[model samples]
Target: MAKMVTKSILMPAALAAALDAEARDKKISLSELARAALSDRINLAAIESRLIARLDAQDEAMAKIIALVSSLEAVDEPEGGVTQ
Candidate 1:
């Protein structure tokens, strides 16, 4: 198990009230609710980062393919509009 330390955070009064209401409705302690929410947000951010990286890689690959095809077409065309 990891060592646990308690930390305090400040939020807007309205947001705090909402969090309290949600915790009460869910029948969980405020700490538990906050911890779960924080964990979920962190996980979601990691997933989003991985997705962005993959999309960037795919974009680079598509650009390369497009450039290669364009070069090939240029090479295949003759100056006199004649077919080989």
Candidate 2:
């Protein structure tokens, strides 16, 4: 098991009141609420990072496809401008 450590943080009075109100509204202790909030934020950041990486990969793939398409030469017209 990991050891738990206690730390203190200072916030503006208005923010502190808001956090306290939220914890009370949820019927949880302030410590628990803060922990949950921090965990949620960390999870959100990880998700955002993965989304960005996937988007970048897609962009690279599309760029390659565009380059391949642009490199191809146009087909010549059929003789007499008509096909049999």
Candidate 3:
């Protein structure tokens, strides 16, 4: 047997009606529809977090590259391209 858990949620009347209609179309209970919606939200959050982390890493790498280029530019070059 499966266990059941109860939760309370508040939503705007229009949104609630939409959810009910969608649930009816899917032939699923309102509870199931709500659970699926919540699960989808959790999945989206996880993906967004990963994307943010990757962007941050890329930004850090770019900053390091810029610093290296600046340091090379600051070096003094001999009058001649090659110093014998």
Highest lDDT, which number? 1
- Model 3 deviation from native, Cα RMSD in Å: 16.3
Writing each residue's lDDT as its tens digit, candidate 1 over 1-84 gives 111111112123434565676678779988887687787732434444554565456667867999999989888889776585
Over 6-54, each residue of candidate 3 has an lDDT whose tens digit, in order, gives 1112123434565666678789998887688687832434444554565
Indicate the TM-score of model 2: 0.40
Output the TM-score of candidate 1. Answer: 0.47
RMSD to native, candidate 1? 15.0
Q: Residue 2 CA error for candidate 1 (Å)?
A: 46
Query: Candidate 3: worst 10 consecutive residues by lDDT?
Result: 1-10
**Residue pairs with backbone overlap in model 2:** none
Residue 74, candidate 1: C-alpha displacement in angstroms: 0.4
Model 2 regions lying over 4 Å from their true place: 1-42, 74-84
- In candidate 1, stretches whose alpha carbon ends up further than 4 angstroms from where it belongs are 1-42, 81-84
Residue 36 of model 1 has an lDDT of 74
Error of 1 at 62 (Å): 0.4
TM-score for each prediction?
Answer: 0.47, 0.40, 0.43
* Better structure of 1 and 3 per TM-score: 1
After superposition on all C-alphas, the RMSD of every candidate to the true structure, in Å, is 15.0, 16.6, 16.3
Candidate 3: misplaced stretches above 4 Å? 1-42, 77-84
